[model samples]
Target chain A: MTIITILDLLGTFVFAISGSLVARNREFDIFGALVVAFATALGGGTIRDLLIGVAPVGWMLDAKYLVAVIAGVGVAAFFSTILLKLRKTLFLFDTIGIGIFTLIGIQKALAQGLSPGVALMMGIVSAVFGGVVRDILCNEVPLIFRKEIYATACLAGGTIYLVGIHLGVNNTVAMVACMLLIIGIRLISVMKKIALPKI
Target chain B: MTIITILDLLGTFVFAISGSLVARNREFDIFGALVVAFATALGGGTIRDLLIGVAPVGWMLDAKYLVAVIAGVGVAAFFSTILLKLRKTLFLFDTIGIGIFTLIGIQKALAQGLSPGVALMMGIVSAVFGGVVRDILCNEVPLIFRKEIYATACLAGGTIYLVGIHLGVNNTVAMVACMLLIIGIRLISVMKKIALPKI
Candidate 1:
């Protein structure tokens, strides 16, 4: 598989696990947990695809993503304590996942002939919408809608991608740089407890 | 506009009003109320169209829906007391809105060559998903996912549409029958306090 595809799958898996964790924490049933996992893994991309007019969505065309999400539910169900212990590690993975997904979203939107501005919005949407949906499902105001720097990090990464491309950077180099930028922004924000001003 | 188109717009308006009311109750700002209203007005059809591969979505193609949603937000913002007094009237409008939107969803799915079962699912999704998204955004478990008979009513209406078609019923007649079925089911369920058995 291409590096992008691998990253995409990994991102989906981690997001699904995060979703299932929230669901389990809320005392949702197994079915509810699975539904949450699926939504978290695929909801952002599904929304993106629908906005860009791509039909059947990405997961519907590829069974591997489904497998990854189901595996996430299984892991969350059977390894809750272990997963809890790995909170730091999981947070790292989640940061990288959002970074990669943001770049992928930008590329997909560009490939679909969207303007740069729209592509940037799509990238941000792809990175944060899953978590938003997950929080909403768990009956919490979405963190992104609060003071979190999450969506802003994605926005920063997408802007970097656009600028890099505009400066004639190679596509692969631009993508990697954008991902790193996103990961760095997210990590720094969390470490410093920085947040956007509340509305 | 055709009767279906008019009904679709009316559905959008009522759904928007419902969404805005929820946001107003939650004490969201006017912008937040408008966002919620738009989501409740167009979210369901947007999902259906995206799943069925129709690009640009219905609201994007018609400005009337946007206007209706804006009007809904205005009504909620400027007349909170009056809106509270009209709760029963609003409920009736919401029921009829779901009924019309359900048939519209089914028709759109069938036009796109989806199977009857899928069409039925699309119908239900169209009727209820906006409210689902609205409730989720407001940090509540979607009523349809709770004990409410909302989605089941849509399913029943869709089934009636399918059976009517199979039995060689006229297209217009079948559409009207399905709409009434949905409205009746929803109204009766509310009046009788009927609910699906909770898991």
Candidate 2:
């Protein structure tokens, strides 16, 4: 019912769809696609929880996320062409999802008494590492490492959020600002094909 | 120094060495090699600990494992040809390492009061997932999933270990038996090119 919960489930669904689509593109079978979809949807949060000592993980406590992921996979499976046509819209939603995930990750890590630097790192990890993981399993260099401004966008947003909180900004206000910054960065950078300069 | 601790460190060393060597073979730069080596040495245990809710993970609390991994990378860098000549010896030690890792993973999960089935999976994850992660990061299908009976060996050993406990077998005896069986299975399977059948 809460907006955060809604965004979290929506993110899970969008992530799973992207994962399933990638698996299909690689000529994977249904089972492999499911595995990839699940990993992409939940792997980041699982890593964050493990690092912060959260037992059972977030998804384990909520069946909604699981249901959303499965639904995403099902939609990807049954509506590949239709989904492909909606790529731009899905990607916008995906960007929003990552922003929310970053916020959630930072909040959870901070709640666990982790230092701000680590909380920021976990935010980026939760935002992008699922796709990082998905790429790895599919036998490619992780996109975040080799290309794109993906994780950096998370870092920037997280930094703003942390700094705002440090400056006594309202929690809800800081969160909204963080999400907006990440979305703007993701969209603008992708449209411009901006990437970190290669070493 | 208990034998278990010693074996654990040695396993970490060997895994790191293998990881470093693989990185070098791929023409990766030193930074990439180091990343691969560290992941190979500790990634499995990290995954296991996270799943079982061990906060901060195993290597975070100890410096020795990091030292071992660094040493392995250094050795691999300077003695690539020499290490290649010792491949058979390294393989033998690696087999032993995997066996010990399996035991440790199972014990840790069981200590956390997880079900035996989950514990068995954790054992395999601990024994081989470091390599799984290494391979994935390096843009290869995880070797265990594709080309070997490696994880099956862990499952076999872990199953025996669990059943032995169920049958009221002595703890130390079961541990040793599990290690020996894993080693035996690994060595024999590799020598005979045994693998699980493709689906």
Candidate number achieving the greatest TM-score relative to the actual structure: 2
Worst 10 residues of 1 chain A by lDDT: A26-35
Clashes of 2: 0
Error of 2 at A53 (Å): 5.3
> Which candidate should be chosen as best, given lDDT against the real structure?
2
Q: Model 1 over residues B1-199: C-alpha lDDT tens digits?
A: 9987787777788788888888878999988999889889888888788887877788887889899999888887788799889889888888888988889888888887776776876887788788777877776876564556788788888899999998999988898888888889888888899876432
Q: What is the TM-score of chain A in candidate 1?
A: 0.96
Q: Give the per-residue lDDT of model 2 (tens digit) for B113-141.
A: 77776688679889888987898788787
lDDT string, candidate 2, A10-80, tens digits: 99999999999888787665545655787899889988887787885777556677788889889998998
- Each model's C-alpha lDDT? 0.82, 0.87
For candidate 1, chain B by itself scores a TM value of 0.95
Could you tell me how far off, in angstroms, the CA of residue B64 lies in candidate 2 after the best superposition? 2.4
Fnat for each model? 0.31, 0.28
CAPRI-style grade of the A/B interface in model 2: incorrect
> Residue-wise lDDT of candidate 1 within A16-133, one digit each (tens)?
8998887766666554566578778888887888788678666655668877898888888888889889999888888888988888788889999999999999998888888777
Q: Which residue pairs in candidate 2 have backbone atoms (N, alpha carbon, C) closer than 3 angstroms, thus clashing? A: none
